[model samples]
Target: MLKNLEPYLEKTIFNSRWILAPFYLGLILGIVLLFIKFIQKTIMMFNTVFSASVSDVIVNILVLVDLSLVASLLLIIIFSGYEIFVSKIDTGDHVDRPSWMGKVDFSGLKLKVIGAIVAISAIDLLKSFMDIPNELSNGEADKLMWKVIIHMTFVVSGLLFAIMDKVVGDTKKH
Candidate 1:
């Protein structure tokens, strides 16, 4: 009877593998978009400096940082998602998987992504404050203060995750 049930269980597991196909396809699509964003940001950066507007130059620098953050996120998803849902990445004899592809666990990647996002948001808020008219009576200072608080929260969370990871690693060694 156990032998008879074996084939049915194997077949179910095999069929379930196809469910991940669509998700992998979406990841491929995301990679393409990230590449496009990289190119666009490069062009904008060059153009901004040529136009000689100090504000535009600063904005373009922020955009470059934003693009880099997005690229990091794309890599985390593509590598880890494949490893988790598809197969172990064949790193071969490579000491480190392409320098950037270091052994980042899921929690570590999440913390990094959250931290990057928070930094980007803070930069955007700063840009907005710079754009505000000097004569306006609106409380721009208060808004900037709130953004700083939110950014600090993200920083603290990321630090906590890093410390937790270190503790877990040490426990495993012992």
Candidate 2:
């Protein structure tokens, strides 16, 4: 009978969270890929450090910063997403464990993601600005304008996300 199968169905549904385990594993792989790129960039930066102009050095540094932010963002997502949706990470009192590992909930995760995105966008914008030549070609000018607009969009979106989260939190209190 349908009623007899209710428990079985419920248990099956509960066990389905394991389906997301592969996704978290994939994200860990992504972090490894980022690390490889980071090392390559570091070598390139070192090679250029002696002869590159100040602006060139700054731009290279910005590239490294951008990669680092992205990698860190991936870590945040991997840790928080796994905890929030999949399962608890059993980091038993390890000295190097991140303080925020188990503390961030879904709402906090959203804010962190948006904040990282805005930061990455800002870094990209700065890099673009630094690379601008004195003579602004029409195409290059348009591209720069588009980058500014895109960066502004990300900034505004992050602000809106924070405001909405705060509003929802306040509503729950009342």
Candidate 3:
């Protein structure tokens, strides 16, 4: 009975990785919602292109670019997380399969996430600066300052993350 219990427990523990499947599925749902939002925003931009101020148009374009980056992040997380934690996605020589779908290791995935975050932050910062009204009040000025500072933090953090990853990778080869 003890030996049987041991194998059963081991198998159960291994199978528990399936518990994460639902979370990946939820991310898919999130992607779908984001796509809907992208479509709506695209339509809005098309409709308002003539009437919108140049700054507003640029800000709207930035928003679309930011969404694109977020969508990319979602894809990276879903594919890399699933392959690294759960199981390999067996695409079986499908030409359309993403080149990096099964190739990204956990460390590489972390760096990719950081890179995407920095890009999204930069886009948002650009939009914030572009959106600044001509008559800037003290409160608005403070808010813009904070946004710039936060974006700089993200850029610095991303650079540090990439440097650390490269150092660790080089050390592994020595």
Query: For this target, which candidate reaches the highest lDDT against the unseen true structure?
Result: 2
- Cα error, residue 3 of model 1, in Å, equals 9.1
Residue 24 error, candidate 1, Å: 3.7
What are the lDDT figures for the candidates, one per model?
A: 0.72, 0.93, 0.91
Clashes of each: 0, 0, 0
Question: For residues 1-174, what per-residue lDDT tens digits would candidate 3 score against the true structure?
Answer: 898799899999999999999999999999999999999999999999999999899999999999889998999999999999898899899999998887799889998998898889889888887877879999999998998898889889888988988888789664
lDDT tens digits by residue: candidate 1, 17-85: 668767877877887887798788887677667766787677667666776666666667777666655
User: Candidate 2 — which residues are off by over 4 angstroms?
Assistant: none
C-alpha lDDT (0 to 100) for residue 159 of candidate 1: 82
Scored against the true structure, residue 54 in model 2 reaches a CA lDDT of 98
**Model 2 Cα shift for residue 95 (angstroms):** 2.3
- Residue-level error in angstroms, candidate 2, position 23: 1.1
Writing each residue's lDDT as its tens digit, candidate 2 over 1-174 gives 999999999999988988998998898899899889989989998998999999999998999899999999999999999989888999899999999998999989999999999999999999999999989999999999999999999989989999998889889664
- Ranking of candidates on lDDT, top first: 2, 3, 1
Instruction: Give the residue spans of candidate 3 off by over 4 A.
Output: 1-4, 172-174
In candidate 3 the C-alpha lDDT for residue 79 amounts to 93
Off by over 4 Å in 1: 1-18, 41-52, 91-102, 118-143, 172-174
